[model samples]
Target: MIIDEQWIYCPVCSNKTRIKVRYNAELKNFPLFCPKCKQENLIDAKGFQIIVIKEPDAKTQSR
Candidate 1:
């Protein structure tokens, strides 16, 4: 199997993150957590860009 990887940066702190993609997987908007800033970021794998989804609220996080 061929695996593809993409490097993503954290918008809040500019932390580098690596994500692996499978050949058959669909590339779409996904949520990622930044370890340094502790924030959820939206990523667009198809466009190779980071998109702003929404800030997670305390209530949603608790669940």
Candidate 2:
């Protein structure tokens, strides 16, 4: 049996994250948390390619 492993990278910091992906893994609308950046980013990943999901900021209630 062969095992394929890949490291997920933080788009913001461009660093390897603690998350790892296998060969038969797929992710969509996933929230990736990076320790180095200390932030969460939405992303879609497949194979070794990752695309960052851009989310709009919520509107704040006016006082």
Candidate 3:
């Protein structure tokens, strides 16, 4: 079992975050929190690629 870490850019704030992905867990969608924008971002790992899924209602400005 090989585990790989990939950097995903947040679509809301363009912040880069790292996510750990496993070979068997490729079909699952991972949730990532952006510290800069304070938004919950989704990471989609399919076809050996990283895709960032942003929620329209999850965007918040930093105080």
Cα-based lDDT for every prediction: 0.64, 0.88, 0.64
TM-score of 1: 0.50
Strongest candidate by lDDT: 2
For candidate 3, lDDT tens digit of each residue in 1-63? 554544556667777755545444574457877778887766777755767765555457454
Give candidate 2's error at residue 57 in angstroms.
1.7
Writing each residue's lDDT as its tens digit, candidate 1 over 1-63 gives 533545667777888755554434454568877877887777655545456666577887974
Task: Indicate the worst ten consecutive residues by lDDT in candidate 2.
Answer: 54-63
Q: Per-residue lDDT tens digits of candidate 2, residues 1-63? A: 665987998999989999999877899999999999799999998876789998766675454
**Which candidate order results from sorting by TM-score in descending order?**
2, 1, 3
In candidate 3, where is summed lDDT lowest over 10 consecutive residues?
A: 19-28
Poorly placed runs, candidate 2 (over 4 Å): 1-3, 60-63
Residue 16, model 2: lDDT of 90
Superposed model 1: Cα runs more than 4 Å off? 1-4, 18-26, 54-63
